[model samples]
Target chain A: MPKLINKNTVITNPWTVMKASTGPEILQVVPGKNFIVPLQFWKLYQEELNEYDGNIAVWLDSDENPEQISDELHSLPLIALNFPVFSDGRSYTNARELRQKYAFKGEIRAIGDVLRDQLYYMAQCGFDTFEIRHDQEAELCLQAFNDFETGYQSTVAEPVPLFRRR
Target chain B: MYRYDGYDHQMLADRVAQFRDQTNRYIDGKLSEIEFLPLRLQNGLYVQRLAPMLRIAVPYGMLSSTQLRKLAYIANHYDKGYAHFTTRQNIQYNWPALVDVPDLLADLAEVEMHAIQTSGNCIRNTTTDQFAGAAPDELEDSRAYCEIIRQWSSFHPEFAYLPRKFKIAVCGTVDDQAATQVHDIGIYIVKGDNDEIGFRILVGGGLGRTPVIGKEIFDFVEKKHLLTALEAILRVYNREGRRDNKYKARIKILVKETGVEEFKNKVTKEWALIKDSSLTLTDEEIDRCQKFFDAPNYQELSNTPTQLTDKLQSNILFAAWHSQNVKPHKVTGYSIVTVCFKETGVAPGDVTDRQLEQIADLSDEYSFGEIRISHKQNIVMADVRQDQLFELWKALESGAMASNNLGLLTDLICCPGGDFCALANAKSIPIAEAIQRKFDDHEELTNIGEMNLNISGCMNACGHHHVGNIGILGVDKKGEEYYQVSLGGSSKNNASLGKIIGPSFAQEEIPDVVETIVGVYKEKRIGEEKFIDTYNRIGIDPFKEKVYAKAD
Candidate 1:
């Protein structure tokens, strides 16, 4: 698994993405491994997912509504939003909605097509952890976190805007 | 005029260094050409038909004398000894090397300026009225608000990767001289019912292949809520804006697809969550930016100076220039003078290095060491005394910057067409020259009255042909260059797109066709009616019948 960088520091990645499957074994979570179920699959097997003993997480596509999973968010360790393309940027808003609107305190992760160039902005919009592509250099990408020392507008991390501070 | 603090200064330095690293990576082949295209564009670098072109932002069309001198230095030492001002109130260097661009940006960053967001899918320059603070009829100065928006949008986290080039314009009056109706987002600063200052927000207005006047999203948004409302709109656009098709991905398409009321609902929904956040401007913050745009010191003098009256009585050319080039100002003794770069045969907005330095010197001598670039492609000195108008006119005439045509037919709003841009269909410069030569006589053009003749070499509408009174578009017919004509478009208060006239004309016939169109306008017009007014009164059919009368 690729290393997860959260807030400019590398962290151990524990969650394994569970592909959509209806197998009998799919409902049984491994004792040590955490499973990140897609929102669709999670909706279909909510009771099965809730009963599992290991850590549980939810991942969403660009079209998935954040409000749909709000009740289940308390049972999850983190919410990962998939970026089909880096330029699409729908997931950034999804992340923002998760943090600001729903008040989801658990970790917010960005996955799929995530790149080094976009990590800084993702961080600004409230993504704490990034699941970078396996082939990319994670350490080098982390440098983007501090690309600019300051920003004019406020973000999730910095509540006071530059203008307000001035 | 907004001064940069240490934080802004360091950010600029860091951005330049980041770009230099990106350039190095591209040169090392670590980043492919396709991968580097958007990166270079965000920095205002374009690989054109000729050499690479670099466009530098002049925020809200305001530039200091020191900035102009720095530009002159760049033009003389780096590229050719000239720079071209664009319709969006920015300057373009035609021949900067691809590698030298980062160095050029470093030079620009020294003077509290950089080329960030000048060209990209992100938000471009925030243009305002050239006479923003000076115009007597304006309600409030819009420059500080524009500066606020600029800072907010610059390197914005979510909005840096928008679908297409986004343009925003602000105007402080009903005049709409900045062509607010044709930008992506337009802000009109106005007084509310209780005499409170607010903005009338318009969104999705643009002038490309699909010409649409922006719809008013909000009739009034309070001053503190400006950033929140804007953020909401941008967030909606970023999340829901079409990304599959490059051409159909502008916010206009999203606004069109969602409908205005529906789009407003979506933005209002987003605004509810972020309205009370840190983005809301404090009164102190507003006052901080407003202080920079405060009025310059002026000496008490007569509105009608004796020297100016003597010059007007003696020199006919000087009097004619004063009547056209000078605009009324808020101050009694001062007037805003537009130093026209449209000297008949020369390109509309091209200025040489020497002229740049000289204009800087002129700004120091006459105006308060500041210059403004108008959307109509001209330079403005806003604080010149009426007594010094004659002397300023004399200096402008010596440098071939004195042209009495401010809004006439020869004052062409044209793009660097097939000559410089790779995407153009024909040569726009030669077309401008041809039309200028055709109407070389001062008396004939003056008789024609107020008319707009805009030219673009392609459908991208950089020349804003869609909003011109008499619009011309260059089309590629087989292998030859052909010109298409449109009539009755206006970007003023009553914003409307031009209708295409029948049959395209060849290069040689363009001037004659323009003359024929103008001939119909002059004949059909009532006493002292402008061309747009005449076209609006007597529909396009009469002129269509006249010009295509011979061809058909």
Candidate 2:
């Protein structure tokens, strides 16, 4: 399990990503079964506000209009989006816009192709939680977030503009 | 020659510290290769086929003697004791280790330099005329404006992650030595009818697989609103530039898709919102930047030196060099000397550490402790006294820097081909060597007059081969290297891409092909007419017939 850092707090990430399985053990949105809402599911089930709980995480496409999601649903406790590939940085912008512009104050997580190099940028863009691949060492990737103590530009994490810094 | 102010210094120092931390995290296994790639690239670090290539920005090609020495030191201590000058007027070290880059940047920062925005999808180092303040035709020093743009674009929040990398070039002279027309944005500073100076803006010009001449957006942009206007253009590009395809992502594609009129309307609509904002320049700030580039104190002397005249009449090599490599400066008795890098058997822009140190010393002694790297891949000592020509030439000769082939056939602008670059389709260095060998005689070269022969390893056009008078493109056919030839292309005020002459030939046949083209020019040219003018008058058919005669 990867250690998730929010502000100064560090805790073990609770989500378990498993390959597709069939039967009662499939775990379709059980009480404790943390689930990631795919783009298709978010589009289909977003209207049925009562179906999903605060614990249900939803994935949002970078190009999708964030306004489509009801503001009340933003109070969900967890959310994770797919990065798709190393070069597909749209997810970072999506994560940032969701947190800063839309004011979604929940635990935004990064999933799929999320590598160590992007940890700092992802954190700056307001992703507090991360679900890295099972094959990678999550502890080492977590340390990469603070690689640079100072940045020349302001980000969502650091709202103070560069010019305002002494 | 923009001096570093407090803010500029602070920004660079902070960026260096930030990159240092990034490097530490990568080394500590905290960052994965995918995560760190963009951050490292934005800092001008690239993993080439052989080793990590670090590109240090030389803002507008102007450098102080102190900066040059630091570069020399870095080259000697870190890399293979040599550095390659890039077409973008920056220097690239071909063999810097990933671990030592932060330290290398710290060395650079001591001289007020950094590698920020040198790569990635960001505003790149702005290039301008090397002879900015020294050129006789210059209306104002373009380097001052280039510095202003550099300051404005450095770590700009909005434009950092554009659709593709952006480049801008400024030229103050009518001659257009900076190759302005081929940049993403080309700004030409001109004096208005009211005796005030402003800019003529050309947007969407670029050279690559697809070459397009920039269309003029504004005849005169008031000097004060320069930054605001630039901001508007960048905003539009950031919002609408294509992201689906890398090749079609440049601003040119957007401009072409939405015709020039519509594009102009969009820019105008955006500009009206912020035209009078704080981004607009004040006269006080412009004058302050101008102060750093104030002309050096010059002693009045006769334009022609008696000793130089006597030497020129006696020594043919000296006479040839003086005619080809030296240009008349705005100051009397001082000349701008171009040290050509297009030497035979050497890569076009490769200079050793010893050569760099020597040039730094020469700049201190002869010039004003300043040097400029020309877009044609040559170095210019912009303030050499006429009396010191012989001594300077002698010093240059020791290091093979006095090539006397500036603007000649041997002065080829070539990219590092298959030998170093993974993207190259074929090798380009051997073809350049063959042509250089073919035109070895100084007297013959002098007679041939000013000519530009450019070669690219691939269609990426890193060498700016499209604008060469005689352009050579290396193409691969079943793993064999073949060269395509073009004619009459230029990058000056009347900028035009070259026209291909017919079929491609094997590498060995390129020198002979070049020789035959030169022969045609020699046969048909009018008195004092250049190879370009002659080819332009007679058309490509004559040369095409001669070159492809045996093949046909």
Model number with the top TM-score: 1
In terms of lDDT, which candidate is strongest?
1
Ten-residue segment with the worst summed lDDT in candidate 1 chain B?
Answer: B30-39
TM-score of chain A of 2: 0.76
Write candidate 2's Cα lDDT for A1-166 as tens digits: 5445443345666664432232223344455556656555545555543453434566665444344565644666766656656555556656655665577887788777766556676777678776665555556576666555644344567655333443
Residue A110 shift from truth in candidate 1, angstroms: 1.5
Q: What is the C-alpha lDDT profile of model 2 across B235-267, one tens digit per residue? A: 677667888999999999999999999999988
| Deviation (Å) of B294 in candidate 1 | 0.5
Per-candidate clashes come to 0, 5
CA shift at B231, candidate 1, in angstroms?
A: 0.6
DockQ of each: 0.67, 0.13
Q: Of the true contacts between chains A and B, what fraction does model 1 have?
A: 0.64
Residue pairs with clashing backbones, model 2: A116-B32, A117-B32, A117-B35, A117-B36, A118-B35
| Candidate 1 CAPRI level | medium
